[model samples]
Target: MSNDKIKEDLPAILERYRDRIEATIKPYLSLNLTPDENLTWWQSKFAGREKSPGGFPYLPKGFDYPQTSDGEYLLLLAQINFAEVPYLEGFPTRGILQFYIADNDSYGFSNYYCELNYPQSNWRVIYFPEPDLNAENLITDFDFLPEKYWFETTELEITKCSAIRWTKKYAPICLEDDSAYKLLLPQIGEAVPFELEDLYEEFTDAYLKILDNDGWFCPLQMGGYSCYFSDDPRVGFSEEEDPFDTLLLKISLIESGSLFFYIQSSALAKCDFSKVLYAMA
Candidate 1:
């Protein structure tokens, strides 16, 4: 990668590639989560019906808490109550979706690279098509957790129960994905009056800059395109071979990078989470 800063005429570039850019656009939900400072672990155990991340989970009575092969409890990464979300086509109108990952160094992803068939024991996605809305009937005791789900700072223990606020957005396919270059370059070449061979890198860099400037680079999103720090997991597979078609959920963590959950369209429509795929990068 070049260290030298490259700038382009952004307006001209946007006008040139407007059609290609528009074609890649898709709708997504941006998760805005705020933690409640006053919330205690005890309160979280009460299992209120809400969308959150990294707090106590909402479990139905008698529901088995997900665990690893060694019987270690998996931690809640995110819990999405679709009923709280704005409606999106092909997504469940009303349901509770929870993502759990083994509380380990790799966060349940043991592989150095992304792959398929990640053991459910390591990571799991649970969907309750008809979720129990009553908090009283939900599991309320989480004393089994090894430690309080809050971190102890030098000052004091800060307990949190994050509350999610969903904002619907139209996100274009990420230009960073290698496949975007393959798909859009030909379209650009035909549309633009000037040759793009020499200006490819400059154009791509500027496009990213424009996206960032416009505040389209969301770290945590549902649906739309998949974002990555390394390789796109769907790279090797052809369209026919790729079963995981939808980016169900994506949570970006600074410590372990990003967690991506994908599901097949058919599976998502039928509310089958058994075939959901997990990948961390």
Candidate 2:
């Protein structure tokens, strides 16, 4: 198959099979997960159970008590040994779907971790705190557009070679070319005029230190900038550092943006502040 065709077919196949996979696993776990809530809900449930002194005793059939490691534990449940799971009908290979659950409650420890692996080809890992609200409701409430979902098209203006045109048109500047900009504009626009004043009061010392270090414009440019692993000759990765750690940090930033946009979009869509605050602490 062509690469493009494979790319197109893969997501469709994954989406089609995702529900069947969740359905098979859900009956064997303590949590009830909707299609949208599957990853986060399962991660939270497993993490909570793993961290507790006694693991969750209420798991359904075919699941075993998780095995504890050095400040972590992993639970391996049912596998797709055959075409028994309805979704595996046409897939060439049918093998294990391992569920790894882990947690650590100590300071600076990773609070939660969950992984769903399909042999070697595809794997997904999620980490987060326990859900304060219903898993389904939390997923629904936080359904904001992903960060990479943006419109990018360049428009060229042409005029007669020797002629100058002075047609007046106004277009608002967009900070991020994504749907969140549209949803956040009303509030952020209102706050823009007062942003400098607010910053002066809220971050006087840090702002001054930034000015001293990198000058006035640096603070504005720094907001959109992110540190990412570079394979480019300049600022390349080091032998000592882990590439996976860099990727995880990058994913964490994306998740942070998604959560922030969801919360700021509406009071109703806001995540439970206590859980977030406690997690940070």
Clashes of each: 0, 0
Q: Which residue pairs overlap in candidate 1's backbone?
A: none
Q: What's each prediction's TM-score?
A: 0.76, 0.19
Which regions in candidate 2 have their CA more than 4 angstroms from the true location?
1-66, 70-92, 103-281
For 1-281, candidate 2 gives per-residue lDDT tens digits of: 12112112223323433333222211100111111112322221211111221112123234333344442233321121112222211221232222232222221114312221222111212112222334333333211211111111112111101111111111111222222222323334434456556533333343223212211111111011122122111122224222111101011111211101011112212222111101110
All models, RMSD in angstroms = 7.1, 23.8
Q: Model 2 misses residue 254 by how many Å?
A: 10
Global lDDT of model 1 = 0.63
Give the clash count for model 1: 0
Q: Where is model 2 poorest over a 10-residue stretch in terms of lDDT?
A: 256-265
